[model samples]
Target: MASVREIKRHIKSVSNIKKITKTMQMVAGAKMQKTLSALLASRPYAQLAWNLLLNLAPKTERELHPLLQIRGIRNSLLVVITSDRGLCGAFNMNVIGEALRQIKDKETHFLITVGKKGRDFFIRRGYKVIAEFTGLGAPAPFISITPISQIIIDEFIKGNVDEVKLVYSDYVSNVIQRPTTIQLLPFQQEQPEEPFLAQFIYEPSPSEVIENLLVRIIEYKIYAAILESQASEFSARMMAMKNATENAENLIQSLILSYNKARQEGITKELTELSTTKAVIESLKK
Candidate 1:
């Protein structure tokens, strides 16, 4: 058995830890609500852009658009999105793990990493990280993300990379986030499920309009994915912090129980010794 003072010290430390975790949980929860809103707002725009691509792609030959032309695999570029700071449970781990699994044993792999976590992980492993940008805001702005998208587009157009893929965590719900890798370039789309006749006049020409739309679509898609990742990060952090707080509370309770037990035992022993001493003194007095 430990001394009562030591037990009390442990209890106090655990209590302080519990307070910190609880505060982090509240912060995460508040951030999650805002990120969720941004994620929801982006979905409709992303969907509409996708639908437009599906409709426009069928009208033109794939070779006319560089982004739509499928080429044989020579080398590939991967864009990975992760959180800047952790305490988000397995969010960053899941994303980094899936990316590594997909790119394992590849001949040539180039990495464009967003977030400190992913960049640091890849660099430390001596992987080829062509570009790294950290501190991307939650629900990243289109203007900021456009440069990242443009770099990949330029690389593909310049015949530097055959394919470009994005790795991110998809926000399914508050309880579930899934790590996923999606091909971002050389896009091929199925015909629109709903039969809506194309009835539009292009300003310059159909090909030119389609080309411009494809660029915007690519940027929007990247932006949307980043938003999804941010939302997932927040949700994961909230859940992780909540669990931490709960576990800390449980630990504090256990420590308090131990401390009380130790204190009681000490008090009982002192009372027993005092009783014995009193009996001896009373006998001596008699």
Candidate 2:
């Protein structure tokens, strides 16, 4: 049997841990809500960008711009999004794993990472990381995405990478986040299942309008991806903290139970000793 003092100490430690986890859970929940709002706000714009691209694709020649040109894939670049800090269950692992699966040793692959976690993981494994951006503030600003998008665009334009893909965790719901990868370069027209006719008149020239629009579209897509990733990170952290808090509570309860049992045994032993002493005194007096 464990001593009451030892069990009491364990209970106190668990209680402290429970307090910390509960606080973290609350913090993550609040952060998730804020990031979710930004994500929701940006979705319509992102969708509009896609619609604009769809309308523009048929009118313009693919050769008008290098971004729209589909080149043979000899080497590729991957942009991976991961949370800078991890307390989230499998959030970083899932993204990093998906990136790893795409890597071909024989084919040269360059990486552009958006988070410290992903950057560090690939670096430790001796992967070539061409670019990295980290410490994006909470509720990342719109301007913060420009550098990343620019780097990707430059790489494609320079023919440094034949293909560009974004690997991230998609925010499905508060309870569900799925790791997903989407091609970002060699722009494809996302056709709707149902046919819808749309037309546009360019102000200057079709090529010039497309060149500008394509840049905006790429920037918006990267921005949207970052927002989705942030939301997922917060959601995952909230769930992980919640689980930790629950586990701590369970441990505290078990420890308290043990402490009570040990204390009870100690009381019983003391009572028995008292009774035995009393009888001995009475017998000696007689």
Candidate 3:
């Protein structure tokens, strides 16, 4: 049992912590709303781009586009996206763990880490990190992620890496964020269920149009993945802070109960001592 003064101090400290966590929860909620809007807005565009790729890819030769050219697995490049800060539960760890599983079987692998957490984690373990990007703002601008995508694109085109993959957290809902791994290169696409009988004429040529669309698709894929990750990070943080605040509140209640019990016991003991002394004095007088 702690002293009354000590218990009071603990209560105050926990109250302060609760205030901080509450503030963080509100901030994360606001950020999550903003990022979620951006994420939702981009989904349609990303899906249409993939559909276009599926429709057009079969009409062209594999060697027609550099991005579509698949090679034997030699060296692989992994782009891992994580949050820069902690206190978000297992958000960063989940993505990092998924990335580790992705590279476990690879003989030659390089990393392009998008956040300080992922970059530091791989660097400390002596993983080959060809590029590192950090300090990406919430609701990250597509332009900021372009350079990161361009690096992997250039590397793949140069035959430095045979395949490129991305590991990130997918935004499922406010309560659930799943670690997801996706291959970005050499542009894998599934066959459409129905064959396209409609023939649309390309403006210049099919190959040239596909070449340009392929780059845009790849860039957009990377951008969309970043958006998804940002949304997930914000969502995870909001829920984590909410939980912390609730836990703090519960702890404060328990501490206050203990403090009152201790104070009541002290007061009762003092009253008992006073009554005992008065009775003794009365007996002596009699």
Candidate 4:
């Protein structure tokens, strides 16, 4: 049994920890709301672009565009996005695991990583980390992704790399984030499953339009992945903090129960001692 002093000290420490976790939960929840809004707003645009590409790219000389052309997946670049700071449970690890599993046996692999966690993990493992960027915001800016996307695009055009794939977490809900991987560059749509594919018309030349569209499409894909990862980060953090807060509350309740039992035991001990002394005094007087 712990002394009351020791127990009190533990309770105080737990209380402080509870405060910190609760504060973090609130902050994460706030950030999650904003991220969710940003991601949701962008979804329509992304979907529309995907649909447009489906409708347009098949009819034109989309093969001329490097981004749209399918190539052998020989020397590939994997872009892995993870959180800079982690208290978000398995969020970062999930992405890292998926990415590592993907490129572990490849003869030659180039990695472009976003976030401190991804860069640190692969670099330590002796992986070839070509470029890394950290300190990206929760809802990362398009400008932040522009350079990263351009580098991959240029590398592909130069035939330095064949295919590029992205690994991140998909934000399903506050309580659920799933590890997701999507191919970025060298995209070949599996033919749109819609009747509207036949009713498409291209302005100017098909080649020119597809050439312009291909760049935008690649940029859009990169942007979408970043947005998804941002939302997932916040969602994971919020969920983790909420769980911590709940666990803290449960512990506090258990501790309070123990504290009450201890106080009752202490009071009972003193009462028993007092009664024994009073009976002895009465017997002496008699």
Candidate 5:
């Protein structure tokens, strides 16, 4: 059994921890709501861009465009997106793991990381980090990522990178986030199940339209992925903080119960000692 003083100290410590965790839970909850809304609002624009590219050009002429040509996946580059801060419940780990799994060591794999966590992880593991960008803790802007995106685009267009893969966590819902990786460059078109695009005629020229649309579509792809990653990070943080608050509450309750028990035992022992001493004095008088 713990002493009364020890139990009291533990109770105070747990109370302090509970206060901190509770505050974090509230902060994460508010930020998660805002980021989630931003991601949702950007979905329509991304879908529109994808649809326009998928419909406006013919598949044959689209292949003639330099960006549409898919070369061998030998020399690949991975763009990893992770949260700048920690305490997000494997939010960064999930995406980092996916990136490691996607990129191989036997080949010449170049990595460009968007967050400090992933950049540090790769550097510690002795992997080559070609580029890195950070300070995007909470509110990440598409404009902030434009320079990085343009660099990757130029590298790919110039035949420096065979393929550009983006590794990030997808925002499934308020409580769910999943690791995902996809080829971001050399855009792939998904044919609809119905024959809707077979009859549509290209405007000026199919190749010209595809060349123009491909550029914007790639940018939109990156913007959408960043938005999804932001939403996922916020959601993970909220869930993690909520769990920490609950665990703190549980610890405080356990410490309180122990404190009461220890104090009761201490009082009982004092009373017993006093009674025994009084009995001994009475015996001596008799």
Candidate 6:
């Protein structure tokens, strides 16, 4: 049992902690809302781009485009997206875990880490990190992520890596986030439901248009993934801070109860001692 003084000190400490956690929670919530808006706005564009690719896949020859050219998976490049700072529960770990699972059996796999957490995790364990980009800021701009997409595109075109994959946390809702793995290179072709009956003329040339569109699609895909990851990170941090604040409140309440109980016991003991002294003095006087 702690004394009243000790319990009071504990209460004060927990109250201060609660204040900090509450502030953090509010901050995270604001960031999450902003990131979520960006994420939602980008999602439709990403889907449309992908659908256009699917429609174009049947028209283009695999030999004409380097991005559509499929090769043996002898070597791979993984782009892992994580948060620069932690304090979020399992957000970074989940992404790292998914990336590890992806490359568990691969013989040659290089990493392009997008955050400090993933970069440090792989580097400390002797993993090959070919490139690293950190502190890209929350709700990362499309322009900032272009270099990362360009790197993978250049690698694929140069035959340096056969396959390119991305590992990120997808934002589902405020309370739910899911780690996701997606292939970015050697675009997969899916047949559309209806066959092409109408023919359309290319603006300048089919090859040049397809080439540029492929590059833009890759860049947009990477940007969308980063946005999803940013939203998820903010959501996770907000929830974690909320939980911490609640726990601190509960702890402070318990400490206050203990402090009151101890103070009451001390007062009872003092009164008992005073009563005893009065009885002895009265008897002595008689």
Write one digit per residue (lDDT tens) for candidate 2, span 85-194.
Answer: 98999899999988888887624999999999999999898888989999988778899998999999999999999999999989999989988899999887655544
Q: Quick one: ranking by TM-score, best first?
A: 2, 6, 1, 3, 5, 4
| Residue lDDT tens for model 6, 1-286 | 8988888888988899999989999998999898888878887887777666666666678898999899898889999999999889899999999999998654599999999999999999888889999988877888898889888999999999999999999999989999999998888677776666667677686777788889998898888889889989989999999999999999988888889999999999999999999999999999
Against the reference, the lDDT scores of all candidates come to 0.86, 0.87, 0.90, 0.81, 0.81, 0.88
- The order by descending lDDT is 3, 6, 2, 1, 4, 5
Expressed as tens digits, the lDDT of each residue in 1-286 for candidate 5 is 8888888888888888878877887887788777777767878987776777666644556457778778887678899998888988989999998998887772588898988899999988878788898886555666776777788888888898888889989999878899999888767767753455356666776677777777777777777787788888878888888898889889888888888888888899999999999999999999
User: For model 1, what is the error of residue 27's alpha carbon versus the real structure, in angstroms, after optimal superposition?
Assistant: 1.9
lDDT of 3 by residue, 126-188 (tens): 999999999879888887877887899899999999999999999998889999999999988
- The C-alpha local distance difference test score for the whole of candidate 6 amounts to 0.88
Give the C-alpha miss distance for residue 168 in model 5, angstroms: 0.8
Q: Give the range where candidate 3 is weakest over 10 consecutive residues by summed lDDT.
A: 100-109
Model 2 collision count: 0
Q: How many clashes in each structure? A: 0, 0, 0, 0, 0, 0
* All models, RMSD in angstroms: 1.8, 2.0, 2.1, 2.9, 2.9, 1.8
lDDT of 4: 0.81
TM-score of each: 0.93, 0.93, 0.92, 0.86, 0.88, 0.93
lDDT of 1 by residue, 1-286 (tens): 8888888888788778878878887887787787778767877987887777776766789888888889998889999999899999999999999899878654599999999999999999888888988877766767898789889999999999999999999999889999999988888567788876857776787788788888988888788788889888988988988898888888878888888898888899999999999999999999
Which residue pairs clash in candidate 1?
none
Worst window of 10 by summed lDDT in candidate 2: 190-199
Let me know the TM-score candidate 3 reaches against the reference structure.
0.92
Candidate 3 achieves a global lDDT of 0.90
Residue-wise C-alpha lDDT for candidate 4, range 129-170, written one tens digit per residue:
989999878777667777887898899988888988889888
